[model samples]
Target chain A: MVREIYQAVADGILVGGVYALMAVGLTLIFGVLDIINIAQGVLVVLGGYLSYSLSTRAHIDLFAGLLITIPAMFALGVVVHWAFIRRLRGAERTSMTLLVTYAVALIVEGVLYKIYGANNVQLSAPYTTASLHVAGFYLPWIYVYGFLLAVALVAAVYLLLYRSRFGRSVRATMANETAARLVGIDTGRVGALTFGIGVAVTAAGGMVFGATNAFNANSGYDLISRLLAIVILGGLGSIAGALAASVFMITLESVVTIWYPTWAIAVFYAALVGVLVIRPRGFFGRKEVRAQ
Target chain B: MIGERGAKAGGLVLLVAAAVAFPLAFPDPAVTNYGVFAMIFVTAASAWNVFSGYSGYISLGHAVFFGSGAYAMGIAARDWNITGAAVFELLPLCAAVGAAIAVPFGLIALRVRRHTFIVITIAIFFIFQLMAFNFSFTGGSAGLSSPFLTWQESVYDTRFYYIALACAAGAVALSWLVRRSSFGLRLRAIRDDEDRASGLGVRAMRVKLSAFAASAGLTATIGAVWFYYVNQVQPQTGFDPLFDLTVVLMTFLGGYGTIAGPVLGALLVEPGTLWLNTQPQLAGASEIVLGVVFLVVVLFVPRGIIPTGGEWIRRLR
Candidate 1:
């Protein structure tokens, strides 16, 4: 029984890493941009489709494909910011951005449906199913690689925030956009760049996700709901908090999933409400700086 | 300028008279169905506006109350072995159920800022959807059927059309009352500036909660009526993500807060949707159209049609 529980924990952590990678960009955008990109889930699916096309058509290795997909997604992100996010102004900016992003989501979903149809497709490679047997546990190679990449990218992002010059500008904008603008930060450029980077991370997360699961265009709604819950529980903008919350929530879910799958899904969402009821502001949310 | 009080009164009487004679003029079920759906959407969207539009908290999860109302009606009809017109009595239960859910949903979600409120609502909506799919009593994805009614097939659509029209009228009336009342003013104040509103002794949380509850209850009652007309309720049908988005779209497309805006939006969009969906070649095209309209409205006319168009009229005059 204990061994089975241990296996579930291991499985949970590995799966959680992939979710953390997907969630990182979402939280980062919210932190700096203050706009919840409702389209992130669909963007992740778009990334997966991009890699699917590359792998099947060009026969590129999935890992090697990120060299192209990540940059490609980043550019798409910039376009989105330039086109929609930049046009929004005044008190309705936050809500309008959400609506516009959702419109973008609908358009993307429609396009994906037109192109991909309703059939489910999964990413395939030798590593996708290959497992590493470690102490009575089977860890899939894709999960292992995805976990390592999540850790590295998270560290790199942390350093970017704490150690780099542009990082300071991003932080300044996050803290107070008007004050940051007053200091001649070119908050527009900062917002555009940060939004791009936030979306770019999804490409890598999408690659792993496509490998592990069979997905269609409609799959994004479920993914968005889960990702939003994780982001909130993780305190919106906190990177470390996102990582912790993803692992904790997914672990609880995986553990419960062993007994009753339906209940696990319920608990996953219930935890978000329960935690907020007690903490109100989430795990590591800002103490005094309320988002206006 | 056609803005005089007598002109407005004449227009109202003319509109009511036209609606009363609509089904009699065209008894075709297909045509009246368009009317039925349009009115149903009007009620939902207008009811939604009373809270989200006034409160300035954009929620993408009103479907939770909608679904709650549907299931309440479905389960009540089944458990009570109801088979006739008596099932209409269950509308009050649907309203109560909607309000009951809203209380807790508001308590937890409203504590957060506006942005987080959107997230909480979406999260809770998905949870309810999951429950409907898994719970044994909800028929476990097979869903529940409405108690069969024996009304003549020709007049069948008329029954639902009038019910929906009545519901839409009530919702619009409520919206008009709330907008004129201090309650609506307080909600708008919170929307503009929560801290300032509370500082002025508004009891922001209490005011927001009541509005949220009122909106939910009204939406749920309509949902119950919808279930009756549709004859079945599935998880996907009852708790639709698209339903939430579509309501927001209609509300935005017409005018966010004005009484006539959602009514006008529903009139235009619903009939067009029903017509377009019936076309065989237009598969999956309606969503793209919806998206384009949404984008156009948000980008060019974010203030929505009524407010912006009203400004244009004032300028011209």
Candidate 2:
């Protein structure tokens, strides 16, 4: 029983890393743009589809496929910003973005449905099925690799935010866009690039997700809810908060499933509500809105 | 003042007359079906507008409120023996149940920042749908059906249609009243600037909570009436994202923050959607079209159908 519990926790942490990476993209967009991209969920699905297409049609490995999918997703993000997001402004910005992003989601969902035909597809790598036994607990090799990728990406994101000159500009824009512009930072360019980078990371998450689950075009609906919950529970624009919340939520659900399989899902949402009621700003999130 | 009030009443009469007469004149069941669906959607949209448009809170997952009302009414009518009550009676019961469930949910969820609030609400709805899917008592994915009460076959059928009409009317009237009331003013204030509203001696929490409760209550009533009209309610069907999307789309297309915007959206788009649905080639393209419509509306008339119309009216005056 203890060993099983340990395995669940181990598995939870591994998968939670990937979720954290996906959620960071969502948080970064919200933090920088003041626009909640409902399309992020669908974008992840898009990422999965891209990877799937590359792996199946081009015979690229799932990890190797990211080499192509990442930049492609980044470009798509820039186009989305120019096409839809750039128009939103003033008091109507938030509500209007919801509508616009939702439209983007539906469009992607439709195209995916057109191409994929609503069938479930999974990425079948040898590592996906292989397990490692460590400390008397079994861990999937895919999860381990996914976790490592997540850590590297998160570290790179941290470096981009803190260590690099571009990172300083991005942070300045996130803190105060008007001030960033006044200081010679091309805030518009930063916004577009941040959005693109936010979307680009989803390709990695998509790869891991495709490896883990049987997904179709419609799977985004469920995935969106979980990702949204993670971001919200972490606090909307806080990357650290998203990371913490993802671990907390996934672990809770994973651990709870051991005791009550049917009730595990409900428990995660219930925890979100409970946590918010107690501390609305989330575990590490600040209450102030980020500069767009 | 009395004359103005009378004029408003006359306008309402004219509007109702036109709606009732149009179907009879057009003599198209297809258009009437759209009208019926539009009226239903208007109820949901008005309910959504209370929390979203009025309070300035974007809820990505209003399906929770709609689903609550649906599941509660479905359970009450299916497992219990409650059926054939006037929609007024059934509606209030559903509304109360919905409010009761929503208050705690709102209390818990409303504490979060704006974007998180939206996400958490969606998650909550997801849980509701998943639970309905997994549980046998909720009929799993197939869902529950109202038993064959004698009323379903009799005058009750036509009466149910009238009930829907009455409910829609109530929702529109309520939305108008709330939009003009002091509560509505405070809600708008909160939406525009929560901190400023708090500074101005408004208890933002109380106002938002009230809006949440009222919206949940109204939408729940709509849900109960919906189940009564449909005869059967399934988990997947009842909790479908399409329903939520329709409500959001209608509210926006009509105009967000305008009491009448969602109604106007229903008027314009619902019939078009119904017509589009009939096209063999466009069968699955309804959602795509809706998305396109949303994009067009957001990019062009961000304020919404009624608000923009109001602006045009002001310009003409």
Candidate 3:
């Protein structure tokens, strides 16, 4: 029993790492642009589809496929911003973004359905099925690779934010957009670039996610809710907070599944509500969140 | 002033009478079925507008109340052998169940900011959906069939049509009454600016909670009626998050925070969706079109049709 519990925790942390990568992208966009990308889940699915096509058609390795998919997703993000998100202005921008992004989600989901026919597909590779025996627990190679990739990308993001010129602009914008503009950071460019980068990371997250779980276009709906819960529990725009909350939530869900399989999914959300009731700002959130 | 009030009241009565007489005038089962759906959507959208449109707290999880009402009716009918008039009488119980769920749901979820509140609502909604799928009482994923009404087909349709119209009328009337009251003013104030409203002693929490509870009750009543009309309940249909999204879209498309907006929205969108569903070549086209419509409306006409039309009329004058 104890070994099974340990295995669940081990499995959860690995899966949670991928969640962290996806959530960081979401949080990054929220932190810099004050826009919640409601389309994030669909974008991840798009990434998975991209990877799926590349791996199946081009015979590219899953990890190697990110080199192509990342840039493609980034460009897609930029185009989306240019076409849809850029024109939104004024006090209702946040709420308006919610609706507009939902529309974006719908369009993408429709296109996916048209092409894929509502079938669940996963990225397949030898590593996906292989497991590593570590002590008494068996760890899947894809999870191990996913976790390592997540750590690397998260570190890269941290470095980009804290150690580079672009990072400085992003942080400045996050802190105060008006000030960032006054400092000649070209805030518009920063916003576009940050959104692109935010979406680019989804390639990695989605590849691993697709490999781990079978997904169709409609799967994005469930994914969005779970991702949103993670980001919200992690304090919306906080990077490290996203990391902590992802692991915590995934672990809790796994443990619950072990004892009460029925309550696993519900517990994920119930914990979110309970936490928010106790600490409205979340674990590391600011007192006054960016209001819509 | 008295004359103007009388004119408005008379107009309202005329409108209600027209709506009540609509299905009878048509006399087609298909048309009446469409009427039933349209009326149900009107009530649902109006219920959504009561809280979200008034308070600017967009709930993506309204299906929680909707599903609760549906499951409540389903359980009562299946377990207690409820049928016919007894099942119809259970509408109040469904409403109560909805309100009961909202109390705790609102207390916890309402504490967060608007953005976080959306997340909480989605979370709670999924939780309920998952529970419906897992709990044996809800009959798991297979769901529960509503008891037979034992009426003639046309009579059943007519009965449900009237019931749906009454529920929709009640929702709209309640909304009208609320909009005229001080409580509605508080809700609007919260929507405009929560901090400022609370600073001015509006008791934001209580006002929001009451509005949420009221909205849930009305929505649940409609849901219960819908369950009866459909004669079945399942997690997918009963707890569909997309249903909540559709209601929000309808309210927005019509005109949020306005008395006549949601009614107008439901009238237009529901029938349009039904028409789209009938199209053989355009499978999955309605959703894509609705998405584009939502984007176009939000970008170009955020104030919605009624307000924009009103503005245009004033400009013409």
- Looking at candidate 2 chain B, the ten consecutive residues that score lowest on lDDT are B152-161
**What DockQ number belongs to candidate 2?**
0.56
Question: What value does DockQ give for candidate 3?
Answer: 0.68
- lDDT for each residue of candidate 3 in B29-51, tens digit (9 for 90 to 100): 98888899999999999999999
Model 1 chain A is weakest, by summed lDDT over 10 consecutive residues, at A283-292
In candidate 2, the residue pairs with backbone N, CA or C atoms under 3 Å apart (3 or more residues apart, or in different chains) clash, namely B254-B261, B254-B305, B255-B304, B255-B305
DockQ for every model comes to: 0.67, 0.56, 0.68
Task: Supply the DockQ value of model 1.
Answer: 0.67
What TM-score is obtained by chain A of candidate 2?
0.96
lDDT tens digits by residue: candidate 1, A58-163: 9999989999999999999999999999999887888899999999989988898888998999898899989999977889999899888878877877889889
Looking at model 3, the pairs that clash are none
Q: Report the lDDT tens digits of candidate 2 across residue range A122-178.
A: 888789999998876788899999999999998889889989999899899888889
The alpha-carbon interface RMSD of model 2 comes to 2.5
Residue B246 lDDT, candidate 2, scale 0-100: 80
lDDT string, candidate 3, A1-292, tens digits:
8888899999999999999999999999999888889899988998999899999999999999999999998998888888888888986677788898899999888888888887799999999999999896899999999999999999999999999999999999999999889989999999999999999988888899999999998988888888898988889889989999999999899988998988888889889888888889888776655344
Instruction: Kindly provide the TM-score of model 2 when superposed on the true structure, using C-alpha atoms.
Output: 0.94
